[model samples]
Target: MVTPVHIRPKDDEIYLDCNATTPVLPQISRAVSHTMEQVFGNPSSSHITGLQARYILDNARRLGCEVIGAERGQLVFTSGATEGIQTAVLSALTAVRKQGQVTAGKYLLYGATEHKAVPQALAHWNELLGTKAELKAIPVDRNGLLDLDFIAQHLPHALMISTMAVNNETGVRQDLATLEKVIRQHAPGVPWMVDCVQMLGKGQLQLAQTSIDYAPFSGHKLYGPKGIGFLYVREHAAFTPLIIGGGQEQGFRSGTENLPGIAAMHTLFELLLDREQQVFKPVATLGAYREQLLAALRTAFPTLELNHAFEYSVPTTLNFSVRGVPSRDIMDVFDAANIRVSSGSACSSKVTRSYVLDAMGLDDWRSQSAIRLSFGPATEQATVDAACARIEEAAQALRHSCLLLSDTNEDFDSELDGVVQLRFDAQCCYLVIDRSAREMAVIDPIPQLADRIEKLVACQHYRVKAVVTTEPQGDDSTAAMLAQLLCASGCDAERDNVGWPLAAQADCSTPVDCDVPTDGCLLVGNRRLYRVGSRQPVYLLSSPIEPTAGARVDFAFVGEQAAPQVLESVLGEHTLVCRKWDDDFAIASQLRELKGEG
Candidate 1:
């Protein structure tokens, strides 16, 4: 085990998003710091200080080549995999330009499940070079394996093709040897670039023995520093420098050498290739760890389904979907327990579904609810045990089914019990269901989600008991529509002379007619709603209301000008505050536990 130079802080969170990026190792940090302090010099100068820096850079390059089984001249240091991709695409298109006129009907192809960077880089450089080559995506099977038949058909007219050794989301590995054979058989001279970023430390690579023209590796993915990576170029392949400056990397790339980052990567490469020390876990050990994690997940979620088959993917990642839960809910519960996971590539935010899973033809539910859990190469057994324990507790909390629904979720028809919060744009609505009686109430319904509410009520055969509006009603169309569907009653306080209603009001045309209590408290079934006095009136729900004054407030609906101090004084700290424009929504049970509730 690598020892820390200083005392480490208490680690309260479990980080399992290593596929997105790994935390820098202590040894790597030391190496970077050492280089910055002792060997700081410009490698381009011809002085003694410069020669010392040059020695360090050259040694790092040689070690990188050895780790990947490449030769001395094959590796060129880059900022990251993205930069390497840009360089490779530029070189390939430059070679095509060197040939006669650009041919019509030519295509540039990439794997359908590739990281967004590959196809994007291909399109960017293709347009800049005026190649006009049609870009196409090679389809993948449900296992996320590239379609070889598609490649064979398009190889004759291809300018270049890009593929990944390992997928980031699914952890699926491709049959690179078979792919290489087919490419050479169809078009021998065409340039092939493989995104080998995820393959480092997880699998072996022998670049010299293969016919691959370009391959890129990133340091951050394998526990080194970010903003540092390398690209491998075949000696006989056509080459052009993407960055042109004072002669560097033999004119292939141009920049002052990042000596500190290079030194950190050198330390990482040493650890990976060190057979004697064996710092990283062996294949068998990692396989055993994966089995333990899978068992824990199955125990937590009895209906768990793997997104990709185990035999085809790397052991470090597990992409899965539970039958009834959405990914946002899962992430919320996990975050409450201090466990970090992801839905898909961190590069794409606010995307509700995984395009990778969609391209593989998975069901809409699976694609919309997939969660990715990834482990670092050096994850310890103790950490695994702690993470498994947290997963179990989080799963138990999710079983209560207090779901947070928004426009982004797809399963709007599912009948869930307890309190379900629905969000539309800036408005919030609640569905309080009494499953035993088959009755539900719609609170603060918005016009945008009117159709969804109708479909849900119809599917579940729910009798709409009442439509209650807490604020002054502007557009009563939504209330009218729900009333027409269910013939439900409406409840609201009488409008005061000051233009602000003492409580909420429904239009007279709607079937709603209810007696507002003198204390501004409305009892709907077993729930009690107290209308707090404000500029824009707010309501508090104390469920299963205790006759005692200390009964806990379960939920609160606040308006635009409901002062924070007023809420803090009136409601308990455990109350789930719902605002008009609150960006994040939390599961009711999880939020309660986080607030120190039983």
Candidate 2:
């Protein structure tokens, strides 16, 4: 008998999807709540309340720019990254037209692996708005890095080029300095916009030192409030205003600002500076955590394959796949075990496969099997340990399920009378019957064999009266799982019994809703099944002695060694029949032995 896994409930839910969105820090939450409660005045007003709001907005602008190494009065607040990207592309293209650079159709270039927002925004402005801008997406290598050679050839013909400072899906960071060098040398003053959404809060972006003309940052990705992000424009860079209304954000972006969200974002930047200093000081501590996690996963799943190299990506993020297992199945198991993870970016988790990996030259199968696990300051060692344990157990269950389905057409002969043994590698289950009584019993059936068992029982025309099982040693319990399936099929298999290794009782109860008594006597037609007591079979089907001292046994269907010497010493004279008589168990045993875990 195999025992079901028992998971301990934790005090708080474990979160590993930081790349999607982080939980707002306590300080940021407090500041946002306080501002929402106290400040509701329009920043453009002249009264004291409005002046205070104006001061808050100005302060946020100043500090936010400084954090990204931009000069004062250069940061423009927007709704979020999507709006910021649209504004940046629109402003750059409009400026190119005004500067007499669109004599031929203006061209916009971006990396092949950029977020969907960048390419789609450019397409919308190019085709729908009659901007006459042409768009080109550069290709990335197998490792998801940009192709610089193609950029060098195409840069001179483009009006603006956009690329992300860090990829959102793979956490692969691009060298902005090198890109800036390429643009300045080859394209010569072609405005560049860096989609730095994922880079914010993780590290400082020296935008002023680089040749990048524009950059975008988001608030929620930095653990601040959502619906507020900023765009950084270099001093004296060519640009046009996207919105034309009341002069807010220096006439670049119009409408009243989200004062609370802006202030909250400012506070987040300040706290982020301190957190990065503490969390990544001397060196990044996340690398050590990554090593621990990878080691644990490797120990649990020897065939785990990493999707991204460590040198090209941030340590806080990882993408990997367990060989031969579907990512959706893995995600489901993790979710059921209370571990939060993602099969792809939150934006495209529903797309079935990752376009990011597909662009990186991975085939559909590998892309479908990929899972992303990102870490944050809140992730602890204990959480990692528990999550890994759960993942390993889930993978093991899947492996067993797959193995059970293999060689389905193969048949085996049993050496026992009135018993048919179905062998799956080293494990064997028995079906017992009394032909005259027309009753049958299934012992320790696995879920993978549910259909086969049902078909066989139906073909035999034997009514399954009771289901029985022996104690399981570990997390491979098939008794409870099998009984539930059998019962659900409208078979009158109402009850199940467990034999030796009494600790299995608690470990075997989670997967089913049925009673597993420690000791019981079940009558299946004319055959009686009961636990073997000391020096005696507890009961016989047809006995006159009442079985108090000892029951005269007709025959026994021995699945495995009942106890140390219970079967051998008691039934020494009785003819012992081998429940399993096939080479399937031998093959399974050899496979396990070759793997060194037999």
Candidate 3:
């Protein structure tokens, strides 16, 4: 029996949502705060400040290098593990594209439940490559575990294989060591990549001990900073840089590094390793909590079904579905009571179910009813008891449905459509623009932002001419932030500034100036050459979908009166505009004017 920490429980704010992001460890917080103040110098700088920072950052890299069992110089500190994955994937694809084989198609072999980012990015690539690589999803059994024999059958024809060391949703260990043995015995040459984002810091990574070519782990997940993570790339394993310039990270990635986050990430790893007994005691406490949790859940909802066979699952994560009750509804109700919990995958807390659940052959009802209750080192027994009780109460509350739950009555109430239901709630902001074949610019994308805009326009009629940041100086509090997000969407982003050179056909830097005076006349062509086009009835969603899908407005429903307001707003501008609403939002739109309207 592993000894647990004597964490004196104070107040009960049981945060069982550690799967999303653990709170920054006190050690990491102190280190990052110190680095922010003392090591403000750039590691790439040559002066004393730079030299000092370089030494500090080098130490950070060395720490990461040592923790993951890589050589001192082999490990590259990335802003986060997401960047690491992007760099690795882009590198792999670039290498494949460079081989000059006309019909050479390198497929991205992935397990069914891999994180959404990996598959989504690859899906975009597959669409571009008429025959890029066929996406072969190795099947998982009824227990949400991968079928090794299934993977064994597919490797002969696959060029690359990517799997997770642990499932983020179910916490099911993938028997990676065993999986590696299978790979060594069967398919030796194919590059095997592991996404250890959910596995790192819990124990040793042993990258050198294993034969995997690349692995990704985020700093935030390891009780480090939110924005930094690292990727382990074995020496001699060639991959392309997603961001090409500045020659940073041994030419694997480019851009000014988030040294602070990286530095703290390194400290988190060091501290975690140094205090494995202290920091990871949550694992044992979680084990005990897990048994209690399962018992209570089984008692309250006797029809509870574990998402996977419990014995093979990791102690930190618990995914189970209750009969009849929607997992989202249960989560929402408990959340209202300040008891935080997540469902299916923490990545999309409101999305209800994960692609992982769907891939596991769960029906929509079964998948939607699933909730993931993960534990951390600090979780207390009483907190677990309260959280479980709250979950049951919430589940019950969700079932008490009344069509008119609100006190307000709708008489002529058709005016609520001026909102955008973001298709994906995880978005930082929404892009509201006319989708035309005209030239465009990215508003303001940081270097970290990948080819998102380009991908959005690649197959479409529209052309992205440039980018702009409404808040360029990051002063009027921010422009680079919104622009940086565009890269994540996969488009080249550039800041729009007043004396900037004109490679762009359109001015992208204009502050959306939501408060500015505007009659919506979208200028297409040039100031003197292009077309001034106006399209009426612009629809807003909480998020944007593919440009090819046309204008679809969607938002979540928050109350009884919410849906009706959506229809009214759409009717106000365009009686025929496509609209969807709920407790999600209050939507509105605008239609182009006809000759008489002026």
**lDDT against the true structure, each candidate:** 0.77, 0.67, 0.58
Global local distance difference test of model 3: 0.58
User: Model 2 over residues 432-503: C-alpha lDDT tens digits?
Assistant: 666665666676665545655665554445566545454432333555554544432433233324422222
Q: Pick the candidate with the highest lDDT.
A: 1
- lDDT by residue for model 1 over 22-70, one digit each (tens)? 9899999999999999989888879998999898888999999999989
Give me the candidate number with maximum TM-score. 1
Q: Sorted by lDDT, highest first, which candidate order results?
A: 1, 2, 3
What's model 1's TM-score? 0.70
TM-score rank order: 1, 2, 3
Q: What is the clash tally of candidate 1?
A: 1
Off by over 4 Å in 3: 1-12, 100-106, 126-131, 275-277, 349-352, 378-598
| Per-residue alpha-carbon lDDT of candidate 3 for residues 1-598, written as tens digits (9 for 90 to 100) | 5456755433655678788877777777888888889888877889998888777767777777777888622677677767777666665655555665442454568889888777776666556644467787778887777888977777776667888888888887788888898777777867777889888755566688778888877877767778787788887776767677998766767777777787687676676557544555655676787888777667556667887776777787888876544564356544565666687676675685677878888765567677887876545577788877865664455344221111133211122113212222212222233443344333323222223333333323344333333222432323344334332233333323311123333423221212122222222232111111111112222223332333322322111122333333332232233222212122232222211232
TM-score versus the correct structure, for each prediction: 0.70, 0.64, 0.62
